[model samples]
Target chain A: MSATLEKGVNAFREVMDAPIASFFNSCVHCGLCADACLFHTETGDPKYTPIYKLEPLKKIWKQEYTLLGKLASMVGLSQPVTDAELEEWSPLVYDSCTLCGRCTVMCPVGNDITYMVRKMREGMAASGHAPAGVIEATRKTIEQGSPMGILPKTFLAQVRDQSEETGIEIPVDQAGADYLVIMSSMEIMGYPEFLGSLARIFKQAGVSWTVSSEAFEATNSGIQIGVSDIARQIVMRIVDAAEKLGVKYVISPECGHAYTALRWDGPNLIGRPYKFGVVHVLELLDQLHKAGRLKTEGKTDEPLTLHDPCQIVRRGGVVAEPRNLLNMVASDFREMEDCGSYNWCCGGGGGVSANHRAEELRFKSFQVKKRQIEGTGVGLMVTACANCRNVLEEGLEHYHMDTKMIGITELVAEYLKEDKPA
Target chain B: MSHMDLLIWARGTGLQLALGVFVAGMVLRFFEIYSLGRKPDLSTPRPGKAWAGWKTIVSRSFPHPSMAKRTYPTVVLGYIFHIGFFVALLFFAPHIRLFRETAGFGWPALPTPLVDAMALAAIIGLLMTLGYRLYHPVKRFLSNFDDYLAWTLTLLPLLTGYMAFHHLLLPYTLMLAVHILSVELLLVFLPFTKLVHVGTIFVSRWYNGDMLGHKGARL
Candidate 1:
């Protein structure tokens, strides 16, 4: 019932489907993934090599699946995956790697190294090798409905504050709404202005939307901790909330993993398609702008660059939506090199920011983003994901840089055209 | 046995045994990979997106422009080694003759000198790659017995083949027998080692592409 090495091995067995089998078999160990990863590039440590991080998984595959490997095991030529080995590898599996998909794109043999890491975390979590911070986050997500342990009452209070500030009555559990807006714990706690921004924009755009009193938490700590059952439970709350409200779409808040959890992984996790469509908040804004439902009066002349979140841009495929929204609001937008889908991670994705033990390494890896920001020579940076914004802020503060960050949705709302609307 | 006898055996029984292991091993390896069927993606794919998997199959072969600076040498050398190896294997006159005899088909062969040049290039590329693997921190950390074994297995045939063609290292009959035997050894081991990537690379690329493509990511 609880964590064990056998259970971990069994989880590994369960996760090893055809693609994984093919990937393990196809790897030539070219080490090109190392160059693609910021952790490896910044640290100059070969242990951070993406494929090397999957050594545990690769060992399991070889021992369990291959003929030569089977023969080797029978003859005592190979060792079984042990608890000590798993403990030793916990940091490599969870701390250093961010599941950014950059290494996945760069693999010469096309091995999806990030996918393997995501799957490998399942085994790590089961075997009691997962980082304590992420596990605690998962526990909080289940017990308090937020990774930050934000209770429903606290979320409602923030909602009330935002509604009062914006002078818009933020709907709560309103059935027959056109959309259901979900917020990650970070957006609710660290950046409540996103709520106000959404309210102002939707009021002007003439859209019908509501926040779920029952399922306001959008981030999935189960995903961060690598437990599918818990992830499915988290997704079902939003699904239930949306279906009960009979909304047409669910808007994922300005969070990277939240969008990935809600839009891409949610259906598969719950084993069914949702009654309502899921859209990133940026995507909805882009759609509203393109359809002429949303209008902007002015563009900011201050030069700024965009930080593309790995999960939302590369993994979730909401690439163009942010660019579309940013162009409408900014006159001096400079793109970082490898902008859009190929942009570097904030070094805090995939629970690295959530895992306190990884703080030093995460800051070290932030050097890549620092160089990227410096390359743009922009004092201001706009990003779509609240988690990325928080991480970027901390990185800038740690490095004592004066670079500033704002969420793209809030930036767009700052330029909203003033007009008469009910 | 005499060099003549060794050459006869390499051209006869050694060829059959190598071919048999190569075929059976590949089938078993493919079965191992494909048998564990994956779950179908249940989520609605991004609508109106082209099949990016097919594009990725061709596109991934070229270094991503953003990654080109960091990866140029490795990718370029990888291409030279693979392309040169294949060119020498399939385009050499003697190789085509052997293919015609075994495969019941033939393609036009490049001139002997051209094939020789390709063989030399392949040898140089592989040597540089081996050096890179030894010198590069990540590659050195990743290398194991299998990587070294695969490398040696691959390089032996090219070295022996070139020597046999030039009659440089040994008597023609002995060198030819050594070349055929080295090629046979490579064939026998191909499906068991990382060299199996020669076939599974396409499958791996397709899966990566398809998963990302389903999300409408331009891989």
Candidate 2:
């Protein structure tokens, strides 16, 4: 059936597995998650509390899963989740939450509030309660290869441009490469320098890396929309391309959620392990540096700080790599308070960047990042995630702060040691 | 029923029924939750997962530094009340005597003055906690009937026990019976209410720590 109330209820029932069951059971109604949430903190609205956002999902779990809840429901004592309720909750589920997962980490009971929110969005999306912008982005990701509707020709053309600009060969679909590198559309369109940087680094390191024309887009809109089926299909394209080329590793681009979708949730979403390893680009760069292949001659003189992308650093375990890589070239590197795994989200993650409806709220939530950067007192900001970079740039500009944002890989590539004569 | 008869009933039959419900309900609830069976994590684990998981059970007992700084009152009061309650429940002389009489086991207890101070502190801590729950916007918003019921049930035993010990509210037998019955009420409600957190917190924290630790995240 269509995205009806019954479909949303049924979806909640279907997804109510053990973690959700225990998470609901274990919640102590401690409002610590509210203080942990940037939305509630920034907006001063209790409704933005992470656990409160899952009221509908909790209702279904209680009614269907718990003995006392079951008894209450059978006796007609408990109120069922209504369409009106879902409608009211749609904004809380989609607009307010970036799914940055601060609350999950901060939850005293370890309730995994972000996981529940992600699961709750499954019902929200099915019931057509998901925001129109996210739904459209998902549609585009399914129809087009990228959420931004960049076709293969567009991606290839960008690759060609990057190759010409770098004066280095950018291989496309070369079989038996050591790495199959993927790029998010944001990088392709907004920051082509990432591809150029990768090309330069791979050249100097003498590494075999090729871009897959078939699966060049790394960002998964299905994940942003909270639809696992579509996310699986999106990830399969990369898995198929990487498998076909027999690459040793599939390099996730400088995108936060893209790294998460590929490195963390990809195997689970596809229900099987990949034929190749999944490594975030920063991780691969750090590996190359450790192997003594990636050599840089000098460091940037400007004072700089890093904004760790929540998904890549916090959720994906690439915490040390960025620091390792950043230390190589950033001599004046200073850390922001609450950096690394505890870093605040740039507020544009989890498809908020794509959802135009969330623009105002997104900017409001960026105040957290704004204060963080302000605390750092550094003009130059180096980050690993392109989305964080973009969001940070916007926040910087919004507040008229002259913080120059650059990709960490590009910074490292700029300082690549010159090739010596043979 | 006469007060003596009521005291006898509360001490014998009522205690048995409440303990039976408490133990059986808790076991069943725990079983249902644990047996739901988490899906096997297929992702590769980082090093020291077991250590991290166990460490998290202890570590989460303290708030994260950032959270602690922001919510010091709640955290401090929470520990005070929990420590006070456990000490009063297990280490107080009267409670130890009750346990020895009922279960044929006893342990060295704190001196009467020490236990008395701890009981008073716990009662004050619980009262502050309840007042915070009622007044604090976020806590108040998050609280439900379960939270208030759990709070009241937990507090009643300590309050009634204190009254019985000091012989303030009624005759010693009646007050003791009230204390026993309040404790029984808590036992019966323990499995059904937020009081279940006493048992489930470790499991939740361990799972969370294990999951995050597998990803190399420090909980």
Candidate 3:
């Protein structure tokens, strides 16, 4: 066994132990998945076909991975896999595909191609087949608790700018607050204004809230890099912090993947659903609108469109909330026909946007987005996810597509009614 | 087209066309897949876990979002083409009754109208999907001659089967000869080309699901 392989064969055995794997024991590929892939779409590469992408795992499963799989493997007819084969598969698996779940969405039978890629990544990561960039990122996240390795004080320093700019008096662990706001590391580094906006929005709405310095970040770069223990450790750190603080609810900042890591999987990974409710900033904003606690005074007339971050809209189902907020602030909103949970990735999700080598793949993947933007005939774009903002800004710069990028919260903050504190 | 004369003519001419399409198509597709082998993506996953990585294939095959998150159409439509297609190839009265002379047991089949409708739908679906393979910019760009050949081979058999069954323009024996020849071609090509995807897709999907679900990645 490779040193990077899971210490025992037990991890492989545990998969069949679950009926989900057994349930998956059945399939006859019609190549329906090819139609749904970003890589296939962007590159017109059939090799990126979702069905073809699964050959490595299939060969192993058929031969040594499962009971029936082994019997099939023994037959001369069984699929085969080799280390050299893995070396070749790395780019197709990592650089070409984004694990964005578009294929999963389009799959006729609900096959999750993204997940398959994730497992392939795990196998690769475990076997030390990970790309140099991914390995480095995973190592950093494992040690630093965030991909960037920004210290807790540095994180606070980033937020301090928000406090100074808005004079919103952002509180940290003010005991007995009704809400605990979870923020992502992206916000800490790039958009401190968002933290100020969250404070301003909440204070105007007459809500009590506190931020956690420990577990301050909601982003799990480990998940992005395909490191499970690193991912779990990140989630557990936040949940432990949430419990220690004893807050009523955890309202996530305007970040897409982080929201999923916390609300959707955090519960299960932490061995239980969180005691407090978990939701995104858009959800909170939506609640404020429904409760008549939020008010907007201005609108941007620039022709604009919305880009739904894949994780937030597609995976987390936080689609309309962002649209509803954007529409409230702007009169001219043209949705890319494929907008909503089905919107294509900005080529930034799944950590691809972060890897230096993946820049070209990122460019190809963003072609769909570029077409969407061009088709919209819009001048400005709004999205809830920071990673989407990073990618769109970077992609536009690279592609020389002239467009403006704005966050939903920052937009909402601009439109907030000027009034006395509620 | 006299009774015996038509049968003999069909056996000779029709079988030749069917075999030519099937064998040539398979050979062309095998080469296409061989070209695709140049792709490094196929070789990315680790080796020697004692089983095939089937996580992604199984999960995506059911409850897809584009299908309105529906399961029935995928299940019913998928099984009919795969299960029914194979059964018809291996067990239809003409194939099975004849095969019994060599190897086999009889199985129930649909009524004439139903079988006719199924064969027709399968042919149309098969061809339409094939045409789509050629037309779709992504599929077209990714396609090799092998891809085209694979589509041709899979569709022709279904088409010939339909024509043979319909027998509006051709005699039954003539059509049946074509159908059987096409089936034999498909059987021979089963391990090569994208046709193999029809088998690989399931295991691939399951592996995908297992990987994502394990990592808490949204599937």
Which model scores highest in DockQ?
1
Query: Which candidate, 1 or 2, has the higher lDDT?
Result: 1
Candidate 3 regions off by >4 Å? Answer: A1-29, A65-69, A75-80, A420-422, B1-219
Model 1 accuracy (lDDT, Cα): 0.91
Residue A43 CA error for candidate 3 (Å)?
A: 1.6
Q: Give per-residue CA lDDT, model 1, range B195-214, as digits (tens).
A: 99988888898899988888
RMSD in Å for model 3: 9.9
Backbone collisions counted per model: 0, 0, 56
Model 2 pairs in collision:
none
Q: Give native contacts recovered, as a fraction, per prediction.
A: 0.80, 0.52, 0.11
TM-score of chain A of each: 0.98, 0.98, 0.92
Q: Give the DockQ (2 decimals) of all models.
A: 0.82, 0.66, 0.09
Q: Per-residue alpha-carbon lDDT of model 2 for A1-422, expressed as tens digits? A: 26888888877876777667778888877788998888888898888888999999988877877789899999999999999999999889888887788887888777788878888888888888988888888888889888888999999999999999999989998999999989888899899999999999999999998998899999998887778889999999999999999999998889988987887788888888788998889988999999999999988889999998888888777888899988899788999988887788888889888888888888888888888888988888998888888888888788888889899989999999989999
Model 3: per-residue lDDT, tens digit, A1-422?
35334421223323322222321333334455665666767786768787566566655544563443465556765645556776677777777766667766666444565656665666665656567776676667667777767678887786677888888788886667778887776777877788888888887899888888887878876676655667789888877777788877788777777876777656655565676777678888999988999988888888899988877777665667888898899989899966775678787777776677778878877888888899999889998888788888988988898899888998998999989666
Error of 2 at A153 (Å): 0.7
Best by TM-score: 1
lDDT of 2 at A175: 97
Error of 1 at A124 (Å): 0.7
**Candidate 3 i-RMS (Å)?**
11.5
